[model samples]
Target: MAILKHIANKSADYGKVLDYMLFQHDDFTKKELLDDKGRKMLREEYYIDGMNCEAMLFDEECEMVNEQYHKNKRYDEIKSHHYILSFDPNDKEDHALTGEKAQALGLEFARNNFPGHQALVCTHTDGHNGSGNVHVHIVINSVRKLDVEKQDFMERECDSRAGFKHHLTNNYLRHLQQSVMDICQRENLYQVNLLSPAADKISEKEYWVNRQGQDKLNELNKQIEADGLTPSKTVFQTQKQSLREAIAEIASTATSLTDFQSGLLENYNISLIHKRGRYSYHLPDCEKNISERALGAHYGKDYLLQQFDKNTKGLEKENTQPEEPQKPISSSFPNEPDVSTIFNPSYDYGKDPIAILFVQTNLQLVVDLQNCVKAQQSEAYAQKVKISNLQQMAKTIAYVQEHEYGSQENLLESFEEVSAKLTDARKTLKETETSLRDINQQIHYTGQYLANKKVYIQMVKSKNKGKFRNEHSSEIALYEAAQKFLKAKNPDRQFPSIKDLKAEKEKLTIKRSAQKDTYNYFRDYQKELRTVCSNVDSILGISRIRQQEQEKSQDIS
Candidate 1:
């Protein structure tokens, strides 16, 4: 059966979607090709010949469609619409269709469904990550001004009188699913009932998030295997799964909606946040709040209430039953301290760093200290780079301003310009700092990955391999993926030993330290710059206030 997923692009740049569909042959490297003009191009993919397309060139087709959309000044936030049509990877019947036939089918679906809209449809033999699923990408301009009619005999058995205010109407989506199912039936392909209620519906975003999470967890497990450590779920994974299961179980048994809410806090560390008529569940260890809708209909407010009513009715005589046994440890936060010890009480109102950055807080002081050190290190690197880049002439000019500019008695006129430059400088410095910090972060993760891989490799070579395989399958998968990536970049490259990995990490650390020192110097210079500019601004501000008063007096006289 074909699965359809919709993606709304707010960037309005259909060109990225075009690049994604046609030219992105590989994710890790840019796909370069010589166009008909013999010029090297990165974005353009030569549209395949004998493919059923309204236009021969993919880029030109998208541009033509989107250009017609710009005539309307109605600035909708959603700029482009992407529909992915995926067929079962194992189905030979689906596989038998040529790219041209698949493309033609996708085009017919798009043209009929999105009448009066410009669309680019392309058939692909594999999923983006090489998942081996045959799929078609239909990227359409949102504007609609033309009428479309369903194929005469293939017309939906439902009413045609109703007009749609939005493109994604429920009736239309149902119709589409039925239409696809019909095609599959006629073509004798494996089919799924798209119209049936999903057992547990997961949105596209959540699906990707879960997949990525699994990938990361698997990657970490690989390191554990290498380290010769007993592989298990990370502290984070254990907590998250524990919370989700606890909520589902608690919701299942609770006698009332209020009891369900209270029971969750009493038994588990989970907390519910209700805002704007939507419910979100949170836990101390959780990086982001998850909505009840995301959790599923079973945990939704209406379902909970309905269950509560049924439970209350069923338990008329046992209303005063004893509470179920809970774990000994306290679940919810009792109360926070008078002052946050991690951040200075005077600085930032002693805010919790966990709230600002979604790092594990249960590890407490060690994690907090590490974060502080990392931030300082990143800052120092940026400062050092700026200072090293400064010319001797600029340094001399800065020195002269520091020593003699204030005495000139005309610095106030330059205050605004200086302030503007200072603002721009700080912004640029921050961007540079972030870039350096990201590199350091990547290096840290890489070191961790390498360390774990070494340990895992040791186990894989011994009798312990089977035990490790059963325990850390995810980790092994991730390790294999990493190896493939490494090999792809350089087929001749061999996996480095633990010593080499550590040596590389140490070099990165040394570079970071030097950058930090330079960053510190530049930071000090920035502070000095701010001070000089602020002092002049203060004088100018006071003078302006006095002039405003003088103007009022002149107007009164």
Candidate 2:
């Protein structure tokens, strides 16, 4: 049986799809008309082995019935639907059938499903990771030509004339999937239920990341056992491990969405970001965000919510039970706790195991930065809300001052003082914000340096020191520069430890926040000043209106 995936081609480029399935593709360069590593050049042709020139035949049919296509002036429209039918990896029929039978089956399926639509079916015998599987590509035009005297299954179902769409409904798709399963059963070939939920699905980008990571790990493992040291695991591996630990830790305690959000923040220092319509999690100081969907079915927000709704008391009871088998997901990881500190509500981060790791090795710098960012964001939000309240108070004062102020001069003087104070306060806030950003950048460099300090020292002491030095010199140099920057701050050339530096950074961060608070307080005070200016303007408008009414009355009198 085949794994079916539907790709809606809006480019209307059926010819491009034809070129791909027919011609050679270089895996390394992703170039056309070049054979991928495993594909034989003679076998990779439009009419080679068991394949035929059916693409050209289909192109002729499309042109013959293309009358109304010229009227469409839109730059973009649904051009074609490209469906991929991939066979099972273990299926030996791929090696025996020579792709002719697969191509025949694909054509029959497409022709029956999209009767009035022009279709091109091509079979290719290759799979990702060189898995021997015969896959078929079906490209059908979006427009169903009634000039062919045939109505598509969809057109007949909708009771409408065919023109711009060769609709593939859920029932039609399921029918195609079932067709594959039936074909496999008749032929005695390996098959799977296409309608069943996929075991796991990862995006193209993540697939490449894992592919490259595995390649790197394989290369690193070839080094002989000396000093019991292996290459550091890839970032992708680290992220997966972190994600698993974070998920498990949070899931155990979280009974509701509110609990889940707080648990993630306090325990993992992960921020939740909403873009478009979906939710994703961002690590500390990282630009890349991974959706809960991408994490896995288990980690998905909806899934976790369901779990939370299902078992609150039972979940606690389960946690207290004996631990599950540790079959070693990571073969190289040491028997150490994944996280250093428990992120309880009243926990002190400075004394956390993660904080100690920052001192020992700045591996958790991103987490530390995340903590600072959330704190800053919360503080800023609170300050802005207070500013809104002050603005309302200012408007209220304006209404009262309109009657109370004896003259415009007194009000104008008060307004001038408020305006000057507001400007000064804004300047201070801007400066504080800038200071905080600079401090963060500095900390990032320092942390980077500290993280690689051990590797730098080891490389220096080794016999073949220059080998790895070149690999990590730029980051090592950055660390050295950061150290110099820190040393200059101390009059006595005494270099403070990483812990001390982090402590000092925390102090500066606090000072910067205090400056913002000062600015906000001044800004709130100036609200009454703005109200006085408003009162003066209102008093003038009222006086002018009265004069105009009196002149009109004089004419009448």
Candidate 3:
């Protein structure tokens, strides 16, 4: 039984997965291998650029052969006939007998059923052992050289349709299985299995391995013996040994088990518990449990306990062992590319989560500034309306004085009344101007804040390389950068520049000790400003209405 499995993904991360599938030695490869990412290397191997198509085979070597076949044939030659066959081994005498039967059956199937199709069969071993389950790769050319020039139209059409080359397809697989089944029945080799009726597919290697049973255990024991250690009689033999060594070392040091456990737990952040029967060392929260079955033989209890003893005498051992000159740090992580510059999308032209959050906050600040500008403009408009009314009143008073000039008494009375009115208007105008100046200054400050905020957002975005979204939020440096922007924009503004704004921002920063707190500060400040403005709208509304009423009265007169 030769088991088959198919897997595929659109991403180019196939190289790492392929290496795992092909080369991993169970625990070693599975544990040591790094995360798989990036584009598949297969495309590069085949030099396929933009060739978005499906591939059938699993092995890379097979892929090379398939590539050659397609390159040589191209589309010029077509397959005229197609045939598939299989053989079983129940009645066959031996491995040689079965192999002969399969080859003969395949050849015969092609000749009888497929008129012009030729057989291209290949055999592969299961790779675990010498169980021979044979399979074939078939390719047939479609184009045929005919002797006669003229032929019946119906027959020519049939030949042309049948001449299309057979590519890999499910139909082809089905055809192969059926062909094998037919041959198996004919040859009386009932043990040959087809994939359908899907008879629990198993690879010949796995089949042989299962049959070989405890021999695999023997191999494991041999590995232990080779490693200069005796085979453990029981599963926890290694753990027990390590425990005994640990206890012996503690006794030598005259140290309590509690002290040792505390030290180990502190360093490793894993639990050390003493049960009634045995002592168990728990794995860290982030780590998966390494099964005793997998590790007990190689990493015996005694070995681990001795390791702890070594750790306890680390300083003494170092004193005895001459200290070599310190080797310079290479600055390169194992298996990592020399990526000096982190792909910080937040800092780059791209938008990361942190950059996005920063931009959004800054944009909000701009919006608040714009609203403040509109508020100032509105107050300015009110001042203009009041001034226009005062000017109109002055004109009327001037006209009255001119008409009463002949009567000294009437003119004097009118002069006094007009003077009072003019004085009041002047006072009102001055106050309005003062208020307008204050509002203008506030608007100016808001504008400055907005500009600084924008720069901060851009700086943060650039720093992150547009990958800010994936970074740890608590570690994000957006806030510090923003604070720098604010300082450069407004040198005089201190820790709490805008009294109300600073208070709100400080609330968010209280818990955060770093730059993260500062960014959060800006977010809270913007939100508070919006709330304050919404509440102040009532006062703004009253001033607007009073100004509008005066204007309407004047318009009516």
lDDT per residue as tens, model 2, 364-402: 101122223233445543443344434433343433333
- lDDT per residue for candidate 1 within 209-326, as digits (tens), equals 6666777887898899899975445423333344556676676667875778897786665788778877788887778997776666666677667777877776874766776664
The reply for model 1, stretches above 4 Å from the true place, is 11-13, 25-54, 61-77, 93-101, 144-175, 185-201, 234-243, 251-263, 272-280, 285-289, 301-557
Error of 2 at 147 (Å): 5.9
Tens-place lDDT per residue, model 3, 168-208, is 35654555455556665544344435553431223334444
What TM-score does each of the candidates earn? 0.42, 0.44, 0.22
lDDT of 2: 0.58
**lDDT of each structure?**
0.54, 0.58, 0.38
Total backbone collisions for each predicted model: 14, 2, 37
Superior candidate under lDDT, 2 versus 3: 2
Question: lDDT at 112 for candidate 2?
Answer: 59
Number of the top lDDT candidate = 2
The TM-score-based order of candidates, best leading, equals 2, 1, 3
lDDT of 3: 0.38
